[model samples]
Target: MPPTSPALRIEVRGVDATEPAVAPALRFLLRLEADAPIRALTLTTQIRIDATGRGYDEQARERLAELFGPPAAWGRNLSSLLWTQTVTHVPAFTGATTAPVTVPCTYDFDVAAAKYLHGLPDGEVPLRFLFTGTLFYAEEGRLQAAHLPWDTESAFRMPVEVWKELMDRHFPRTAWIRLERDTFDRLYAHRVRHTLLGWDDAVRSLLETSGG
Candidate 1:
């Protein structure tokens, strides 16, 4: 519950003027270490700055606080979350400040993600939000680890970009849906004609493998 070490700013080096809005996310992607821990200097999700930190959006802090709990609050930051999850971090200062510990972070995508997706709101979300990475997961309302990483493709066999965009445009509110016969048939036909991979065969294999 140690407030992400009082959310502070540090003069980071090697960060380009144009970096991904999510630095940690970029770090994970660029490195992609099997279980390597990562550290980066970026705007704190907990600290609210009047000035936008370079490429970071001004509202990122507020938005994150609203979606997740207050990460800056004494007991609600990532440090506390990681502690609860038993992910170890090295206590080292960086860029004139001590940030989240640098350690090899592990992401067990398959297990943790299956849990998160089962409960997320089924709604029209921007397709841009979709990406392949380990998302933070705290279960039983308890933070589980540094994160539960997932290759969005391997984790979910669905063509998420296409599906999400379609749903966002077409099905804004409905959930638990089964595509109509005509629609499914059309999609299946399109898959057969365009993509060499047989949708039915691949899907059937996945279903059988998962025991679904």
Candidate 2:
């Protein structure tokens, strides 16, 4: 009879935002265990935001209209949103092991994931991680390879504060906006014509004119 493959399990132990030493990133601690020795692991993780996992206050719902349409249509619109895909290697281990998943985040409002995360007022962000990859192991003194089970997954409720802290460290009391080349040229021209001391003043002036 052929050697049976070992069943693998994964769990999200904890999360933390990197500081100046490791700026602009969030790291997740994953604990993995298996019945047999794992020679090597190449893990592909798909991170998703479960919009329906948490309740949103009235104010938060209003702020999230752009992403989910309106509160009334939430039942249909509030599905999981793919945040990012990351691949990390796990070193050889026996029985159990812990690994770190470093996810680089962006504060650009143009991105849907960024917008959704920024719109949240408070509370934990529900995250679902789907994993897939190849697993290497040794059976009866012979090396072997097997496909990771399709149902391998993990759920984590990451605190919003972690993300907020990361952004604050990278951009204190500021935000990022990406503009088209033409739009930027027009804004620059207006600033020069108005003798605006800085980009902030030029933007404030435009906002005032538009009653924003």
Candidate 3:
């Protein structure tokens, strides 16, 4: 009789702010299980926000209007949002092992993921993880490699506070936004022309002038 191929399973246990809190990032704890000993693993994960999996508050719905249109149309417009893709190398393990999947975060409002996250109020952020990779193992004293199943996936509801805390640690009270070079040049000229002490003053002056 022939030996059966090994199978793998993955689960997300929890999430936390990265250690040292030096930058904006989050770490997802993953439990990896296999029927047979795994010599090595090259894992690729695609993290997505299941936008429709959870409910949103009125404020959140209003804020997210730019992304999903009016709340009335959200029934059809809301869909999964691709957050990020990360790759990690898992060390040798016999039956089960734990790994950390670190995801870097940005505060730039120009980024859709950031905007979506910021729009949310207090609640868990529905997340989906899609995984595909290659695994290496010993078969009869010979090195063997196998491709992971295409259906490997997991779901997790990450707290919005975790992301907010991470950003606060790195950026304090400041937020970031990107602008076109031409626009920046014009803003800079306006700032200089008005002898504004800071960018905030220049922007506020413009907003007031425009009746914003």
Candidate 4:
């Protein structure tokens, strides 16, 4: 069901919802996937629906509770501080369904790959976060009714500092990146993105690289 009122749109702001707010680092990944600014997401329809007294907020709270529990797997305590090694900004070009969205993470990944290209210790390279999410626009504001997929994953044994530089240069709009405490060391490969890569040639590259 689309939003009953254009103003009564639904939005899921990616955040650190676990234990004292999800880790800022993980929250950063979610923020990158959001359609609007992190803060605006929660109050998307607040002023518009406030006058109607529809209890939209309450309903949203419940819906979010259910969605976040499964959709978002990263708990709190994840954060990042940018430290650059060698960074470069390049245009992100990708698309799916006739929508052209930039694949900034690809640039970040390629940039981060420099270290490995140069041959650096696995641990010396910083962790890489390529969290990707898509927001569907169906009719009006019924975000809940739309089907948007979320994919979060990382590359490990990487030099941490180098990854930050890559993100800073290619994907600054994204927020902090930090090491997961448990260190699930093996390359925790997930189809994560800083933004939704349209299902096009650009996305094809990812699939090809992943052997999809």
| Top candidate, metric TM-score | 2
* Cα lDDT, model 3, residue 96: 95
RMSD of each: 18.2, 1.3, 1.4, 22.9
List the candidate 1 regions with Cα displacement exceeding 4 Å.
1-86, 92-96, 101-113, 122-196, 199-212
- For model 1, which pairs clash? 36-104, 36-105, 37-103, 37-104, 37-105, 134-149
CA shift of 155, model 4, Å = 3.4
Model 3 RMSD vs true structure: 1.4
TM-score of each: 0.18, 0.95, 0.95, 0.17
lDDT of 1 by residue, 29-79 (tens): 111222222242221121111111112223444444433345345144322
Q: Model 4: per-residue lDDT, tens digit, 45-155?
A: 100101111122333334333322322331331123222222112122212111111212233223323222222222242333332233333333333322222333333
Please give the TM-score that candidate 1 achieves against the real structure: 0.18
Better of 2 and 3 by TM-score: 2
Candidate 2 per-residue lDDT, tens place, 27-80, comes to 999999999999999999999999899999999999899999988999889888
Q: Which consecutive 10 residues in model 1 have the weakest lDDT in total?
A: 23-32
C-alpha-based local distance difference test score of model 3: 0.92
lDDT of the structure predicted as candidate 1 = 0.29
Ranking by lDDT: 3, 2, 1, 4
Cand. 4 TM to true fold? 0.17
For model 3, the stretches where C-alpha displacement exceeds 4 angstroms are: 1-3
Give the winner by lDDT. Answer: 3
Question: Distance from true position, residue 5, model 3, in Å?
Answer: 2.5
Residue 133 lDDT (model 4): 31
- Give the C-alpha miss distance for residue 123 in model 4, angstroms: 4.2
